[model samples]
Target: MAASAGPVLSREEVDRALARLGAERDAVESALLSLQDHPGLRLLDGADLTGRTQERWAVVGQGLPMLWALFDRYSEALASARAVRARKPRPGGPELAELSELLTGDAVTVPGGAPDGPQRLGAPARLVERVSLDGLMDRMNAWYATVLEVVSAADAVWTALPARIDLLIAELRRVQTLAASLGVRVGGHPLGDDLDALDADLGGLRTEVRSDPLALWRPARVPAQRGTVPDGGALATPSGVVDTERFDLAGRALDGVRLELENLLRLRDDAEERLQGVGDLLQRADATLAEARRARGEVLAKIAATEVPAVPGPASALRERIVVALELRQSGQWYRLAPLLDALEDAAAKELARARQSLTEVTQPLAVRAELRGRLDAYKAMAARLRVAEDPEVVERYEKARWLLWSAPCDLRAAAGAVARFQQALRPAPGGPDDGAATGPADLVDAVDAVDAADGTQQGGAWAGGEPADGQAVDGRVQGGRG
Candidate 1:
């Protein structure tokens, strides 16, 4: 219902509008310069952008020059109006009428005018119906805003991606060097192959990201609320989103390499421990063999009748294996050294145990003779305490056992039988004339008899009250049954 024409301005109103117009021009000029000098805009101009960013920038590039052209036209119109008012001390009715038209009316003119009239800057084909000074300013502000969106998006992608890629590349190189030192070849270890593949992939991905950042960006659509008519929504941001999945994959690959390195270091430590154990076992075996050799000479000289086993010499073959294992450890072949050290440790322990067994076997008869001598004297002292050392049968058996046991080239088999017979004589005769209160000697005899029973002997008369000298009922004859 309002008139199509602009409202008329008095002199004061014209002057006020001019001041306001000049302020708008200054602000607009500052905005234009800032947009032109913006880092994002500079990057957008020089960068080899791609995909949606490339397409959008092409449109923005075309629109930018048109926006500048329109701003120039707006500036010229304001200047001409200001000059007309400056000619008089005060604007008259005629002067005010002309100023009113310039201040509020359609004032911007396109140079090389269209066949119809003034037009939008770049779209000369579509003639502009009418544009006032204020309308032109609004159009320029819109163009500036749209161009800034594209420029900022490109700059944001550039800022976040390239530096991150460089850091990842540095980490990848460090891992690659470590892998090579560990003998992890591309075709040998799966992790090595994976690292190699990642190297190639990261190289290509970095190039792609640098050259065409927008192509890698993901666009997420925010869901509209239910039960509301959805308006055409602007994007949350025009900037490219980083390809986080690829970066995470790269980080995971490096972590795997780091884990492998840790495992190898642990293996190296275990290998060193195993080598130390192998050395200890081999040294113990050598010492055991030396002791066995010394015992062999003593056994031959003292027990003339016994055949001594020859002490085995140090295990030269096993020693050679230890040398080889040590070499493997020095060479950093932890995998190879681990199994070798295990085998060497087992073999060395067996050799040491065998040497000890040989020494025990070769000197066994001498030990038995010594044991028999002590048993004979122990029973003699026992019988003397019991007032029965002068028993003729016991003396005869004792002397026979002693001579066989004490003489060099002692017949140990005969000596063992003599000692057993002497021990049997020391037992109290069942229903024979040897009854009295039990003494310490009888208790000692019972203790020796208990030992004999454990060795599968069934002695007839060791205890004064007899149940075959033990608690067992023997052959239905209970000589000393509990009352």
Candidate 2:
């Protein structure tokens, strides 16, 4: 941004400035030459670029010729200055001033922003342009930097994202092959659909990254880093090189598909064990069902006027499905087996839970009687603690409830009503510390104890022997549903 037209120089200073101009001319030419041959620029030149890169690079391509023309103009001006100096021995004031202006002032005429060559930077609308020697050098510096920015940013993205995507594509190929061998699917859709989508997205991304990399960059608030050309001199710093959010998304999606395929492969390795576990769960379910049937008989004999839920037959169908799963596993049809195993395992677990629940249902009346008895005793204890046991209403209700509860073949529905009556009389009377409010009943029967009547519950019921929660395989044995 700084452009200074320096004061008149001495002859030696003028000569030094000219020599410096020559050095600067060489530096500019080298920078431009390197840019012309840069691989990234070559790609840009041929590619049908899109988006912001298309717009910006078009300006660079058009503007490029002006740089060469200006460089030519600078050389001629230097040659003319040299010729004048050589005309007089130990040149005087006029020769020195002319040399001084040629070194520091806008002493050259360059091609304009016309139809043929690169445009003058700011005055794109102008046909002709003039800049001092220092100005010409500065212009080339800025122009070279711009060219590098486009070329470097595009190459950076090409380097960063495409190679990773290619590696992912390679991994994807392996996954696809594995999936095809096993006939795997993701949520009922073949992996080919995902592969197609991934190919389209990543392929499009690679092309776009090559052609229009600037579109992927983050907007830079600060200026890009100025770099020296490989040969010599400065080039423009490339702006916001690569923003990988899109690339990252595509990569993760690809990984997810690959992981899904891998999971199916793993399922093949352990399908037999998994099927065996399912068999174990079904066996446990059968045992629990038998226990429920036995318990129902006991409930019918012991609890009067109580309904017991019917126990289902053994979970033979679920166990039978294991044969099919084994066949699939043996054939390496992992996709089919994976879903089947999922359904079969789920069914086995529910069967166990259902069997346990049936046992609980059949024996529910006995549990109710026990719960009512406990509540009755709790209320009695609370009454004694409150010194209300002697209240005639409490005494009468408690005795009647106790008689029914203690009887064999207890009518639980009637007995429950009697307990409720006993509890009603135990409420605090109005106009005391109680103030007519019924103090809540004691913490009795808050929960019906988990009625696991199966052979060995979790403590002694369903899926005994360190039950695996949810029909999961444990030590190659499936166990779950401690009800």
lDDT of 1 by residue, 1-483 (tens): 112246568778888889988887877776677777878778778878766667666666654576678778889989999999999978787777777777777766654322221123234354453567766766665566566556655567677877888888898888778767666668877767888888898898787776666666553421111111012121223333655688778878778876876576676778777777777877877777777777667667666545667888888898788789878778776545656776887897898788777766655655666655766777677667666678899899888878877776676556666777778777766455644535544565675576556544456432222222333322122121111
Q: Candidate 2 — which pairs collide? A: 63-118, 105-132, 106-131, 106-132, 145-236, 430-436, 456-460, 456-461, 457-460, 457-461
Task: Give the poorly placed runs of model 1, Cα more than 4 Å off.
Answer: 1-5, 87-89, 92-100, 110-129, 215-245, 262-270, 278-483
TM-scores across all candidates? 0.53, 0.61
| Steric collisions counted per model | 0, 10
lDDT of 2 by residue, 1-483 (tens): 123356767878867876777777787787768777777777778888899898878776644576677678878888887887787878888777776677677777766653221234344455666677656665655566556766777777776877877887787677767767777545546665787677788778877776788787764633223333443464545657579887788778878888877888788778778888888888888888888788787777767865566877876666678888888788777867888999998998898888888777666666666666776777677667656688898899889888887887776656656766665565443333532223432321211112222211233221222222454321122122211
In model 1, state the lDDT of residue 264.
65
lDDT of each: 0.66, 0.67
In candidate 1, list every pair of residues with a backbone clash: none
Candidate 2's C-alpha runs over 4 A off are: 1-8, 114-127, 185-187, 190-192, 219-232, 287-311, 316-340, 349-483
